[model samples]
Target: MIIQAVAHRGYPKKYAENTLSSFLKAVELGFSHLELDVHLSKDGIPVVIHDHTLDRMTNGTGRVVDYTASELQSFRVKQDEHIPTLEEVLRALKGKIQLNIELKQMGDYYPELEKRVLEVIEAFDMLDQVVITSFDFDALERIRQLSRDVRIGLITFGGSKAILDWSLEMGATFLSMHYAFVTEHYIQRCQDLGIQLMAWTINESSVMKQFQEYPSVWICTDELEGFMDVLEMSGSI
Candidate 1:
């Protein structure tokens, strides 16, 4: 399979990251996959927000779950964008791109997260369009334990052979990793094991160059134009 360009939080510097407009812009640029964050709202609904606290990303005054989905919907996100529901995002990106929805349930919030996320995805009839990821291996485990259908990805701050083994046991189809932890040997290991390797938040040309030099490495970047230009010049896109 060919590597794809994924928008990081939806062209963040220019548009509101994780909002509907931001995601649409990425799709317009021909990016077929997007990396986004999912957090539980006060009513146990899954909303697409990047942080646990809403201070930085929205006009809200507290934690994400502190506000109901309707309460959050009215709040102005960065650049005055509405806090988009996961349903809106799925509808907008429907047939446009694959979504890598990173689950960030901390403390005791993981209880309904698996059900809410899977329910939304299932309602949209988008089992193939969605991939769930988390730094919390237990979250991935629970999501996997819920069903055999959903595709799961392991995102990590670091990695090792043991971690990879654990990922396999959890039934993950891909590993989203930091660029520092990825290497030729690791890539080979992934390929040998029939798993895809995707690295995130790569916004610089230097990292793209490194990924380009390696075969079958999927790099998710925010600089879509710059990344495409580099890839075109190097014949790597």
Candidate 2:
């Protein structure tokens, strides 16, 4: 069994995270799985970004929901990088690889985001290859309501079985969680329940080595090439 690698925000070390350049870099590096974050704009467009506010990643300062998609185009992630619409991302990476689209909606509910994201994915014919994930259990529920065929994942941080229980209740087939929560016992339980496990933000080689035993688990990482090197040295890749 070989552990799979899921590029977190498409190789953030080489390009700005959640941008087209980053995703393209991930594809060039031969990564089959990609993870990204999405937030709905004021005009109901799902934009690819990690934060609720634009200040951290882009020149803009307001909450992402306050600005329309077109308005966000003016704010630059850098001189060359601008905020990308979810449609643009879907078109760019459409047939190249599988995607994990993390919904960024937390407290302020955006009722149309789930519908809009599904619409974009449907247009691109990527429904089967995509997994919709979020820390908000309600958001995952909404996604389940919209389409049972679409894969839904629960993103969590702690090592509690309650998270798995809630994820099961939401009909989630995947659990995306912090690496610290994963254990042999937990992995076995998830396998028993038929839930696939994915560990997030794993960058260290030592930690990567630790998860090699779980061949089916997907390890999400920022250092895509480095993780591959670890696997290569271990003769696992």
Candidate 3:
């Protein structure tokens, strides 16, 4: 089977995370799987970003929830790139790549985040090309009730029977976890449930080589170009 390579935060080393340019560069580099995070703006628009606070990635300060979508756009990332909305990212990469959108949970924020995100996905006609994932299992369960066909993944930090059970109960198609948690038994358990495994942040060539022997369907990483080169050299792609 052909393992998928997901660009974590869309080639962040070269471009700003969650920006249109970053996603475009991932596509240009031949990455079909793109992983991103989503948070609702104060105005109820779903914006693509990873952090709850804007201080680290953007020119703005304070919580990202404080700004409207338009206001958030004013903040520059790495000088030129501005924060992008989920719709902008969906529009830019809809046909070119598969998206794994992580729904960020902020207390009393984006009460309808799952619904809004599904609306955007439906609007872009990308329901088949996206997998909604989160550490919030409740959100995933709610999403399942809204749309039975939407693909969802359970994001976890460890490999355990409890995690597997939860994922299976939620009808998750993928189990996304930290790379260190992936083991032979973990792979088998996921496989038994017909769930594809996705290992995250595997940047080391040695670790990548080790994971290549496993049955993970996708490997998410920051070093997309480097990992791709390694895979090609090893004839694993």
Candidate 4:
């Protein structure tokens, strides 16, 4: 089986998560897919970062939405890397890799965030190369309303049939779930339903070996090298 390893947050083990440098490194390391998060800045621009707040990942100390894209860039991630606008990431990785852009929303959704994100993807002409994902069902519905051609994925922590049904209802082609919840039965169900499954943030060698039996499932992980090693060990590379 071929292992499809998606660089989660662009090789977070080596570089600061979600930074352009990390993304470039992932690309350079021959990863074909990368996953990143998107949140709207105060000025309505989509910026690349995982959290609603910048306190953990950067030198800043407040909500990311409180600052404009320019202001947010002033804060350094790991004291050197600046927060990247979504456009910057798209421009840099346009042809190099496929992107899984998660519409990150906690508590309240961003104003017109789905529309704005679509606009950016359209501007880059990357609708075919990117899949917009979200844990928010409403946000995914909003995305469907705006564009029919762009692909959508539902990010869920639970491995329930209801979640799968809801994904089908919304015409989502992909379902991203936490790796721990994924089972052989679950993989078969996804395959039967014609929906692709992405196992998120998987780093363990045992889990990596287990997933190798199912070539249809994509593995999203921070340890790109570790996944590669597993592939090599199995002579599947």
In model 3, where do residues sit more than 4 Å from their true spots? 1-3, 106-108
* Candidate 2: clashing pairs of residues: none
| lDDT string, candidate 1, 95-130, tens digits | 888899999966466468878988899999999998
Per candidate, the number of residue pairs that clash is 0, 0, 0, 0
What value does the lDDT take at residue 169 in candidate 4?
Answer: 83
- Between prediction 1 and prediction 2, the one with superior lDDT is 2
lDDT of each: 0.83, 0.87, 0.86, 0.91
In the range 43-153, model 2's lDDT, one tens digit per residue, is: 999999998888998877989889999998789996689889989999898888889999986755776788899999998889988999988877888888989889998
Residue 24 accuracy (lDDT) in model 3: 88
lDDT of 4 by residue, 1-237 (tens): 323678999989999999999999999888878999999999999999999999999989999999999999999999889999999999999988999999997536698899999999999999989999998888889999999889998998868989888878888889999988888999999999999899987899998899888888999988888999998999878
Q: What RMSD does each model have against the real structure?
A: 1.8, 1.8, 1.8, 1.6
lDDT at residue 223 of model 2 (Cα atoms): 93
Candidate 4 Cα errors over 4 Å, as ranges: 1-3
Residue 43, candidate 2: alpha-carbon lDDT: 92
In terms of lDDT, which candidate is strongest?
4
Error of 2 at 153 (Å): 0.9
Q: Any idea what lDDT model 2 has? A: 0.87
**What's the lDDT of the predicted structure labeled candidate 3?**
0.86
Which residue pairs collide, candidate 3? none
Can you tell me which runs of candidate 2 are displaced by over 4 Å?
A: 1-3
RMSD of 2: 1.8
